[model samples]
Target: MTSSTDRVAIVTGGSGGIGRVSVERLARDGLAVVVHYAGNKDRADETVASVVDAGGRAIAVGGDVADEHRMGAVFDAAEQEFGGVDVLVHTAGIMPLSPIAQLDLDTFDRVQRTNVRGTFVVDQLAAKRMRAGGAIVNFSTSVTRLQIPGYGAYAASKGAVEALTLILARELRGRDITVNAVSPGPTATPLFFEGKTPEQIDGIAGANPMGRLGTPEDIAEMVSFLAGPARWVNGQVLYVNGGAA
Candidate 1:
């Protein structure tokens, strides 16, 4: 097993939102990190700075999550900089909501590419290259169970993620690498707030028994666990939602 301080991680979407917080959390846990961004180099750099400021090692890399070559480069960077990647916290995805009937085919395809294909790209690389005793935490949404009307495209995309995550865990048998997904319910991230109004946010928060939106930190804590210590926990979608059902 890699010592905690010697472990390294690649956090896709580490530029902003939950991914950013997860990077910080993992860094604090003593892992060198490769912070990935889709288009926000500045945000990724800032995330890296935060880790570096805290006396951790980190570097920011930008790429399209669904692009194999680009994502390959991300892994390459992690290897080049930190020796090799031990954990992959794949929090990079899109949530463009529209009722199924109203959603355009183009938008639907984009959602699939970013969410499903992106997951495949990164997970495939990690499955092939990540060190044993590492973990993969793929992001999923509780809306898949919530059956929210306008979330058709987004939810469907995450459904694919769930399936891929489960199957990969089985396929990686005997590798000592744990693969799992985190299903978050109404986390207070920019993605969740994209088209939501204040009232809508309030209503969703009220629905959760906790009566508050899940913060990025809340989700990051779970990421920290799955990546660092949850060795026996594998092939499950751990719902971090505050019992919003």
Candidate 2:
């Protein structure tokens, strides 16, 4: 395993929500981090400032996750700034909720482009460029198992992420790299709170055995593990849902 001091990580969607927290968490773990944002430059700057204040090395880069050229630039920025990438936590994704029958084809396509294609693009770059003993973590959703009514398209996108994660792990045979996915349950990020009623949120939180909503920090901790010492734990989707299953 690579030592934290020598490791470099690129965290896509590192500007806000779970991605923001994951950047800080990995930085705290002693890895130099490249924080990737889609359009929110201000938020991305804030995340970088927080890491700097904490005495961790970090730089923010902007790009659309699904765009191959843009994401290649993200990887390029990491190598230029910190040498080479050793870990990639791909948290950049969208969650647009709509029933399958009512969901427009455009929305469905957008969801796939961002979530599924995004994972593939970044994972491909990481597979080719990341140093040996690297880790590639893709984000998935617990809703795939929950089968929530309005999550059809979103869940379908994450399902593809999970499949890619498993296949990529096997594809990287003899490379000593670990590929895995983190399936998070209802997390209390802006994404989850948006369009959610208080009663609905409460009901969902109560359904979990932990009786509380998962936090961005909770998911970050899992990513930190996978990005570091969890070498034997590859090609698996570790669900971090507080026993919500």
Question: What is the per-residue lDDT of model 1 for residues 1-245, given as tens digits with 9 covering 90 to 100?
Answer: 79989999999999999999999999999999999999999989999999999999999999999999999999999999999999999999988878888999999999999999999999999999999899999999998898988999999999999999999999999999999999999898888888888999989989889989999999999999999889999999989999977
Give the per-residue lDDT digits (tens) of candidate 2, residues 1-245.
Answer: 66899899999999999999999999999999999999999999999999999999999999999999999999999899999999999999999888899999999999999999999999999999999999999999999899999999999999999999999999999999999999999999999999999999999999999999999999999999999989899999999999987
TM-score on alpha carbons, each prediction: 0.99, 0.99
Query: Model 2, poorest ten-residue lDDT window?
Result: 1-10
76 Cα displacement, candidate 2 (Å): 0.8
Off by over 4 Å in 2: none
